[model samples]
Target: MPTNYYKLNLASLPDGLYNQETDVKEWLALTTTSKGSFPPDSLNRVLRMDSSVELERIIGISLWMVGNVLPFVLPLFILASILSSTGLVLLKAFLTYVAVLASLNKFIFAPMFMKRYKRKQLSNTDIKDNQYLHTERNNQKYNSLQFVWPESVNRPALNDKPVIFTAIPHGAVPLGITCYPVWSKLFNDKLCHWTCAPVVLKLPIVSSFMKHMGYIPAKAKHIVDTLTKKEENVGVVLDGIAGMFRSDKNTEIANIKQRKGIIKIALRAGVPIVPTYGFGHTSLWKIVVDPFGILEALSLKLDISLTPFFGRWGWFLGPPQRVPLCVALGEPVLCPKIDEPTQDDIDKYHSQLLQSYADLFECHKASYGWANKKLVFV
Candidate 1:
């Protein structure tokens, strides 16, 4: 048995971890006390927090605002200036302030946030005794995050070899990918280095957080170095900035028809590609579409989403919606390690990966409340 293999105990988790209306009931259906027994109430109580938990939750959301939400405020301010009577003078002032703060983010705020997060982690006294505390700690920040590993996929033997994890439908924030720590704890602490847009590493506080979280730049050389030379698992967002524009409440679009670079990277390193989908990832934000397709073009060229978006509260404000955040990992598509894979080899593996992703979605769509929805590959 692999060191990472642990019995799936859906019953042992806390109440809010899984959405009650969805497949969580079905997940726990077979585990009724009539069969054997459930975990003790004391274990559940560990996750249930006191008054301090609320404060911690607020701070977590605030930090999220700093890292994920702050960079775009200047753009919003510019738009507001155009619409409102607010003159360009005020806007220029705000722009200058934003610039100075962005510069100071790395030197001042990033270290402070990192220290606070680390301190909170160390403060969890029960972390060592109860391994599930990893998930609990992560949920402190992301309220509705969940992981569903279908029985069809084999348990990742992290000790055996490193695997490439490809996450789909990159949300406005890609919150699921940032949950790498929780994923690492499950796989016996073998960290999967996530690849992010090169621009992300240049952002103010977000870059620091990404670097602290062990994110590699989404460059071919950097990815190849992490897989081949460093011999570690790597995770990539397949659709990236393009998918952010396509995010919608009614439909799920995977902008991956043109994404074959990662496949080639996997082939070069001889690593298996795991088709991972973050269901309800798009539900976290409401994107304002550009009918003219102008924002999409600019976003691709800039390697970042310039599309106007909003969270649960309103335009670029408030925490993400409390939707059930479930990331499902599918069976791996094995590929041969070829130093110089021809176009034929790349196309073959890419096609297999596409099928794997589609199959993964079809297998577990209904469980997460997407019964009638189909994954449209653009």
Candidate 2:
């Protein structure tokens, strides 16, 4: 999927012995050796998989799962054990059940879920105007103290030209998605909207609330229409469902390099790419599955990803921590229009867009308490 993984510019990085070519044989050879000492700021870890920190995240995620979801689902699981002992449909009737579920999900469920919103006056609040897309109608769920803006950086001035916010590394439902209005006010309420999974708006008894709140499914047509028709900006988690599974110990190894679909959208929709970075997102919650685990792979097939992510409940509302969430918005990178964009265009601009994140992290890591971190693009 990576057309040119070697286009990364290592020269700009501080000089040291880096496996730039990524010599796997050498890496395996050196795996057990005592790691040589390097300067403090030098790249040491790939994705911030620090044992202590990651362990804390893992424990947090486990508590949420074991304490929260497990209690509720355990009964259904136990019932399944009895039913399975009597030859149940858990595995034998998988195809039959799935086909039935799919049919219901499409025809009966989705329409009924959307009907509630249509019956209400929620649709009138669409933020398609060129003016600010956010407002002061703050949601009670958000605590302003948690999301702190970086003082070292100033918010970029937005214009009438449509902007595509490429929110990368899909770290634990980025605080922006959770506390949108406060997030908007933090940025002087620069009007912007976000996209979510189709499942979010397709569920029974739940879809109406999200639809009323202005969340759209992350479909290409919906994204294209929202960006162009409304003349408004949209913040998309570029990784979508797949990115949630891609989170790992490394805080910096993002999958965005090969995911050039955003580049194509920018080229076609005539929007500039804003490589927005949420420095502490990946570190917020510890997900307890392998990046390439069977659950992750299976989730991809279903167009949804699941993670029993866990974090401290108090931390969610408590005052900002020492390393609080600080989002950095980068300057817009203009893309050249091509009637039919080639691989060269995607690769070339994806590299440039990747560099923007590196620059953003390097420039502001210290003020945000990530001084020892290096934004490595793989």
Candidate 3:
């Protein structure tokens, strides 16, 4: 025979009781038939309640919805939508628009967006005003040495003629820097063709930085077309951006887990696979592994980290290790002109590319400080 009011006041009451109370209140508010059912006194009191407190609660609910519920619900909703005629049409139209927008954004709008975003983000932080690094006038001083260039002594020349280089993500080496020197030295010396990914041209600070080093954003098709003119040195990163996972002194190519777009591009373009490695690249920063063990994939996708070289040994460009940090320019594997490449062809080339990388790693293991490390498949 305990009073209902006393039961509501107890701290030991189940959380669900509070939830049920809230639901009842909501239902009561919604289903009010007569004005007196919701007394003017009660309505006035509720209306007069702290708006800031209500707002905070709403925000918390919204954040929970977005962070937890939306991820699973959105995919299911999209799937259900796809099963309907209107939904399918809308989805198709949306996808087409998104694809077009992505292409345009990468090639054009991204640079501007990056610059604006960087400036805004920096302005909000307590960063010091360094005149040399930040000012437009000091841009020339920053251009003293071309940081991005090839280590090869016999660097090919890139005349006004365009040459294409696919920027890959192996050894976590930002090939952009190494490739710059290659382009300038090769193009300046020989005056042959040179080109690279259009995405590079659209990076805010990076685009200008690249242009100064003599690289234009070149399409893959254009690169192949240019190659047909003469024996063109079209460079490509076999392990695209996923190469960033490689641990220091690890001989195994960690990039095999990802898609081999570079292989496809190489096969289509008929370019020789250049198995390259960069020593002391990953040592540039510290990587935090997922603690929960559940979000590792998502964490990698987001790349949630401090600045590229913060709280660790800042990056250093070693004098390119010709042997181990090696660029094994393998013999050109001729590709057939086919409408669709077979899986076997893809697998064969992928294996060859992987073996070439392993061989190069083995050949220079001692010099690069990876002699003791075992080549892990993953």
When superposed on Cα atoms, how far off is each prediction in RMSD? Answer: 8.5, 16.0, 27.1
Task: Give the Cα-based TM-score of candidate 1 against the true structure.
Answer: 0.72
Q: How many backbone clashes does candidate 2 have?
A: 8
Q: Over the stretch 12-89, how does candidate 3's per-residue lDDT look in tens digits?
A: 212232221133332222221221112112211101223332232223222222232233344665786778988776
- Model 3: how far is 201 from its true place, Å? 3.2
Error of 1 at 234 (Å): 0.7
What lDDT tens digits, residue by residue, belong to model 2 across residues 1-378?
211101111112211222123232332232221122112322212322224333333333232233323333446656775777644444335335335544654465334433521222234554322111111111111211122122222233344366677776676545534444322333333446677778766754345645655567877788777767866666788766566655444356566667788787777787777777765667656556764587777767776545555455543211222224445555457876665788888888888888877766665566455676666554
> Per-prediction TM-score, please?
0.72, 0.59, 0.43
Q: Candidate 1 residues 9-78, lDDT tens each?
A: 3324443443212332343343212111112221111223344333443345434554554577667777
Error of 2 at 259 (Å): 1.1
Would you list the clashing residue pairs of candidate 1?
Answer: none
How far residue 367's Cα lies from its native spot in candidate 2, in Å, is 1.7
Off by over 4 Å in 2: 1-157, 182-191, 245-250, 290-292, 313-323
